[model samples]
Target: MRAVRFHEHGGPDVLRVDEIDKPEISAHEILVEVAGAGVNPVDTYIREGATQPFTLPMIPGIDVGGTVAAVGDGVSGFDIGDPVYGTGIGKNHYGGYAEYVTVPDDRLVQLPEGVDPMVAGAAGVVSGTAWRALIDHGNLQAADTCLIHGGSGGVGHAAVQIAAASGANVITTAAPTYHDALTDLGADVVLDYGRSDLADAVRDAAGGGVDVILDHRLHEYLQFDADVANVGCRVLGIGENETGVGFERSSATRRKDLQLTMMTMFNTPDLRVPLRKLAYLMSEGDLEISIAETYGLEDAAKAQQHVIEESFLGKVVIVP
Candidate 1:
């Protein structure tokens, strides 16, 4: 199979397209012929050495949309011709960046009706993460005011729509350039991320501190989590910049009573349920996907470059 590989990591130029052996399947796995692969911030992070401990010559895509070309011996409920889409947990395995890739049958979901291949692959990861934050972790209610960081980006836009549809007034942070776009995605108020006094602006727009906040960048906002959280409110967000694996500052977080949401969509047992729910929303028009930009499979370099160049509004795709 022809696929892109990077033996040594540095920049997008390290990615090289060449023929590699197709992945071998285990008894409970399925092989997909790639239709589209979703490019994420993590893809670039891994490529650029920011996130590592990875094996060299890695293919860094996590989400893929395609049809089952072959099924392993013990697999059931899925046929060779069925359309499928899934996100591979990139902890140790090869991912969805080639003409063929293998995944455990349990991790795959039937591609939802009324959706295209690109949309299915694109929406899988962040949509699941956003839903896990708002619906599962935050315990958001109809009257709640929920604030989301990175409002114009992939996860933020999904959270904005879901929270608003669930009846919460959603406040979000975004660059001034994205205010109009964020509002169209159901953000009740869009605060400038460059400003430090957004709490005051949020108070002016809504009555008080928010009942919940879904965070993406936590290092800069770690102290502010309590300042804006309503007393007893759930601060369900991830602080990925802890400088190490396990989050530090346990005493402070405990003092705040923060319900820090640790979302790992790939490891859980019941992913398909939430994944199906996400597709239903998209098909019914309650959810919308924003594509910052797209590139062909051979143009993977440019796609990764764009992610480094700008903090974008939504997920990017590489169509093979």
Candidate 2:
């Protein structure tokens, strides 16, 4: 099997394509023949040795969509040739950036009918993260007014749709170029994130303050979120600055009694639960995975670069 592996942590240039033996499955694992793999910003962080400690020569892909080539003896409810997609592949083990990779049975969800492999591959992390942020952590409800930052990005896009489908008044911030698309995706209000009066805009849109806030750039938006959140609001933070910058709790944050939750998809105890729901949403057309770009396995380095440095509306996928 051909795989893209980085022997050392650095820039995307460190990723290289190599012919490697296919991974073997454990009793609780399933061997997936890779069809598409999603490249995420965290992949770049992992490649640069910025996150948790990882071994060298790692394959840096987290989301995968592929077919079950072989099933573990202990794994039930799956068989060879079944389409599957999920995350947690590249974090601690050999990941999806190869022709074949081993994934835990519980981490692999059956791809719903009519979902394309590329979209399924891209949907895993973003959709699951969005579901966790908006539905689980933020506790968004139909009567709530939800504000989502970076609504044109991967998780942002998914979060907007999820918030809308939940019947919440979805207020999202994105570039003006994406406002129409986001509105079509169920965002009730689309504000320009670059606007100087973004907080005021959000307050106006939500009729004073939003009930829930989903933020990816906490460092940039923490105080802004506090300013625009309704009393007792829930704010979910999924990403932040890699520079280890600190934020101060503002008076509004304290006075309003905001509930702040920082989350990572890996921290989820049962990934299959949220993954199953996201798959169902995809199947029902309530959720859509937008592919910003697709690259061959050999161009994994470029894919990583595009994911981190480039500004794109959705996920970048690797087709092996």
Candidate 3:
């Protein structure tokens, strides 16, 4: 099998496609013939040795969509020809950047009818993360006003649709170029993050304050989030600056008794549940996964670079 592996962590240049042996499955693992693998910002970080330690010569994809090529003896409810997609493929194991990857049976979900493998692969991480952040951790409700930062990225775009489908008044921040697209995705209000009065704009959009905030760049937006958060609001922190930046808790955050929770999709004990729900949403056309670009498996380096250095409104996928 051909796989993209980085022997050492540094930059996208470190990723190289090489012919490798196929991974064997454990009793509870299933072997997937990779059709599409989603490239995330975290993949870049992992390649740069920024995240937790990993085995050298690592495959860096976290999300995968493909068919079951082989199943372990203990694996059930999946067959050799079933289409599947899910996350956790790259974090704890070699990942999905190869022609074949061994994934735990529990981590793979049957692709809902009519959902494309590439779409499923691209949505695995972002959709699951958005669902967990807004629905599970944030407890966003239909009556709530939700504010999502970086609403043009992979997770941001998914969050916009998820929040909107949940009936929340979705207020998102993105560049002017993405405003109309975000609104089409169910964002009730889309503001330019570059606006000097972003906080005020958010407050006005949400009618004084927002009930929930999904923030990825907390170091840059923590104070701003506090400024526009409603009393007893929930702030779900999905990411932060990698530079060891510090942020002060604003007086409004304390005064409003807001709840601040930092989360990573990897922490979810059961991904299949949310993924199943997202799958239903996708099948029903309530959720849409946009593919910003697709690259061949050999161009994994370019895919990783585009994920970090480029500004795109969806996921970058690798077709193996």
Which predicted model would earn the best lDDT? 3
Candidate 3, residue 203: lDDT: 93
Candidate order (TM-score): 3, 2, 1
Candidate 2 RMSD computed on C-alpha atoms after optimal superposition onto the true structure:
1.4
lDDT of 1 at 155: 81
Candidate 3 local Cα displacement, residue 241, angstroms? 1.4
Write one digit per residue (lDDT tens) for candidate 3, span 117-213. 7779888889999999999989999979999998999999999999999999999999999899999999999999999988888999898998999
Can you write out model 2's per-residue Cα lDDT over 153-175, one digit (the tens) per residue?
Answer: 99999999998889999999998
Candidate 1 residues lying further than 4 Å off, grouped into runs, are 49-55, 239-256
TM-score of 2: 0.97
- Which pairs clash (backbone N, Cα, C closer than 3 Å) in model 3? none
Instruction: Report the Cα lDDT for candidate 1.
Output: 0.77
lDDT of 1 by residue, 180-290 (tens): 998998888899988977877876666877788887777666557666766667876554566644335556556556666656555556767777788788878888878
Q: Report lDDT per candidate.
A: 0.77, 0.87, 0.89
Model 1 clash number = 0
